[model samples]
Target: AEIGKGFLLPSASISSKTKEQMPAIPKEIERAEEEGVKILYLTLPTEITGKNGRVNGLKCVPLVLDEIDAEGRRKPLPISASEFLLK
Candidate 1:
């Protein structure tokens, strides 16, 4: 992931099990910038089973398409699923 105005990118391999790119909400990003967090690591959540001891990757439903109007206009829409993977 890239951060800061210079867009310093991280060199890390995301697992294939990762479903989607975790989005940084504008508000949170602004706050992080204001707080002087030039580089931030966002950890995603993983699914656990049984006694919640073992992790089984992450479950996610990607946002396919944004809602459209009859005139083929786009509208501001929120993300659908909240699935994530912590690594």
Candidate 2:
């Protein structure tokens, strides 16, 4: 998140179990209709326009959810984020 801000880009972090975890998702995505986010780092499944070369119509950057299991082992879980591509 800081990386974007360091570049002087507006960035926001949202939490969700899925795409509809909150009512604000749609509204946030709606901003895409105008001067919206150039890129989306989604932790959950969300809809995309599929306009660019973005694989599976998902966000550009995929985040890893590092979690600990019952055995107290480290695990890297992918939260369904896809490859980042631009047209």
Candidate 3:
């Protein structure tokens, strides 16, 4: 992905004991601050949508990387825009 033209690669870390991958939300926040990103668009699962209409935390969902479409490309994950804040 380009610096500001394309999407940033998903930032995550893998657990040593359980071998489970975890999203590095703090790291992503740091990166956004460093890059001077005013608004970061995130697509977290609906399960994480918190109380008071806020989304909190991250949960890793297993994906079959080998699965592809007729174009041999991975399918895009579904996303629903819950709320939008504008200044």
Relative to the true structure, how large is the alpha-carbon lDDT of every model? Answer: 0.40, 0.46, 0.40
Inter-residue clash pairs, candidate 2 = none
Compose the digit string of candidate 3's lDDT tens values, residues 1-87: 126546553433323211123245667655754665543333232334455876555443322333478997654343333433221
Q: Pick the candidate with the highest TM-score.
A: 2
Candidate 1 at 64: error in angstroms? 2.3
lDDT of 1 by residue, 1-87 (tens): 234446443223222221233264667655754655533233222353333675534442223334578989543332456455422
Q: Worst lDDT window (10 residues) for model 2?
A: 13-22
Off by over 4 Å in 1: 1-27, 33-57, 71-87
Q: Write one digit per residue (lDDT tens) for candidate 2, span 1-87.
A: 334545554554433333443355686665642443443333443345453664433343355646767888544345453544433
- Give me the runs in candidate 3 sitting further than 4 Å from their true place: 1-44, 49-62, 76-87
Between candidates 2 and 3, which one is better according to TM-score? 2
If scored against the real structure, what TM-score would every candidate get?
0.23, 0.26, 0.23
Clashes of 3: 0
